[model samples]
Target: MSLTANLMKTGDAKDGAGSEFLAFTLGSEEYGIDILKVQEIRGYEAVTRIANAPEFIKGVINLRGIIIPVVDMRIKFNLGTPTYDQFTVVIILNIGGRIMGMVVDSVSDVTTLSPDQIKPAPEMGSAFNSDYMIGLGTIDERMLILVDIDKLMSSGEMGLIDKMAA
Candidate 1:
């Protein structure tokens, strides 16, 4: 959809609580990511594992001619063992001019959420970090955990992304 149309449907990102999010599933939970950061969505493909890389970093995939690092959200979040099926999806994100891919269980659809509908994420515990969370968005009875993909992708733990960008 065009920018004007999107704004009309979802509201204004700057002025109001309106921002579009790409909803995806990880385990049994629903998560939302800023639509602006999403470059493309593709089906899961076999990736070449990287040597001496973190377990969460599932290695790289050659996109066109560029090899982009892929991270498994299930492993990163300790959700459980992830199974790659025909329905698995890879969300390609462009953050800070660097491109990376995130493996997700399945992608639903893009939903527009207003700020008023999003509530602050509750604290789980000291061990449970919510630093990368933007907030919790509510749509009807479903709650979408909004993530700051840019922050999560550029974090020090995501060393591969930094190395690739350099």
Candidate 2:
């Protein structure tokens, strides 16, 4: 299925109670993810590559002996390849019972967006799709691309990694 269809499905799954996001930056754009799914954030480190893995999969990192696959959000979001340097950090997130890490350029600050503040993602015909984006959050003058990490991960696609780890 397409990313937009997946996001629409996820948006419909949730009833209420509001949601919070941890904002971060990749290149010039700002993005956010549900805070409840974020496990932890750590500095970038060398990871062990897995054979025959997806291009977006950076590799597996042993986080205190629990191996977790890391995805380069830059590539996954079609934001292009990221130049890793001192500012790079890994945002470990748990989505749909799977633990994965995403390498981001840098992390901004956490922001809360009530249901009212979020507007459904805008549809634009282009190479880069906005299906993973749940909505656009406006806080003050800054715009946060509220991302549905679960949909972004596409749990079904990651089932292989989970099976390997199991």
Candidate 3:
């Protein structure tokens, strides 16, 4: 079965398993997003830089004739210098019918977290805005920064996503 379908099936249990999230790393921190938003994961590749585009927006990549904008999470969050290595990956996401790629350090795995395991994101001043955070997910000893990918991607500042469709 497709990963999406499989994950959906796994999450379908009425036992209150809550939602599934695709976990990925951005620097040393781990983050998670709703697995349903993820279309696929791909190895990082060179992109054609857009003239005058924001620094965080690396550029666009032609995926089977359709050009999709790729955003570098490290640069966008001011994590530090980003290195392109075998571990680097681009998470292709389908947000509101718009396909886009997000560059992350690497993908770990899909995790299932119950509602009780999620805690509200603390209001704080940081490079990554809390407004776009779903909450903090705790699984054993690991704490994942749960991101609201749709909100972050369609925010006014990104500009890459069309406002009308967002």
TM-score list, all predictions: 0.87, 0.82, 0.89
lDDT of 1 by residue, 101-136 (tens): 999999887788877989998877643369888899
For model 2, the superposed segments whose C-alpha errors exceed 4 Å read 1-18, 163-166
Q: Please tell me which predicted candidate would have the highest lDDT against the true structure.
A: 3
In what order do the candidates fall by TM-score, top score first? 3, 1, 2
Best by TM-score: 3
| Per-residue lDDT of candidate 3, residues 98-137 (tens digit) | 9999999988888888899999999989877899999999
Query: lDDT per model, in order?
Result: 0.84, 0.79, 0.86
Cα RMSD for candidates in order:
3.9, 8.3, 3.1
* Candidate 2 residue lDDT tens string, 1-166: 2422433344444465567678889889999998778777888999888888787788899998888988888886678778999878898888877888999998866566777888889996764467777989987788998887887687566666675455
lDDT for position 38 in model 2: 77
Question: Positional deviation of 116 in candidate 2, in angstroms?
Answer: 2.3
Which ten contiguous residues of candidate 3 have the minimum total lDDT?
157-166
